[model samples]
Target: MMTHIVSKATYRTHMIALFMCLTFLWPCAICLYCTDFSRNVDHYCSFCNAFIGTYE
Candidate 1:
């Protein structure tokens, strides 16, 4: 059996990439959804504000 080894740095990079992808996925999906149905202006604005981590 041939075993492949992954270095710590490579593993760390892959983990960070995966984490970033998952982290942004939800906000982006919500943003796109809000964009599609922008009839509710307040709803869109709130989600966008939440995405940017700011609320006024």
Candidate 2:
């Protein structure tokens, strides 16, 4: 019989990496989807057409 085991430290590291990736990617995806590049107007999201913010 063969057995495989994952160490606690390794598991924790993987979990932390996954959480960081999720936190970073989720917002980036939403931003990309909501952003409107067709119109060169105010910085407003296309989905809700809400002004996000100004660059300068």
Candidate 3:
């Protein structure tokens, strides 16, 4: 019975770790996607250089 309880706790910990990993990696994936989009926009925009110079 103690082994069974420990097994369940281990399972829960594994799941929590998986969820945390996904939570962290998913935002990085989204940021990369957005970065790609922004790069595309900068490449296409005629006045992008001017805008970046003023803002950044």
Encode model 3's per-residue lDDT on 1-56: one tens digit a residue: 11111111234344545665688865544444334322222222344333222111
Residue clash pairs of candidate 2: none
Q: For candidate 2, lDDT tens digit of each residue in 1-56?
A: 22232222234344545665688765444333344322133355656666565432
lDDT of each residue in 1-56, candidate 1, tens digit only: 22232222234344545665688765544443334222222212233333222111
Measured on C-alpha atoms, candidate 1 has an lDDT of 0.36
Residue pair clashes in candidate 3: none
The better-scoring model by lDDT among 1 and 3 is: 1
* lDDT ranking, best first: 2, 1, 3
Model 2, residue 12: distance off in Å is 0.2
Predicted model with the maximum lDDT: 2
Q: What TM-score does model 2 achieve against the real structure? A: 0.28
Model 2 segments more than 4 A misplaced: 1-9, 25-56
TM-score of each: 0.28, 0.28, 0.28
Cand. 3 Cα-lDDT? 0.35
Q: Indicate the residue-level lDDT of 11 in model 3.
A: 42
What RMSD, rounded to one decimal, does every model reach? 21.5, 22.3, 22.7
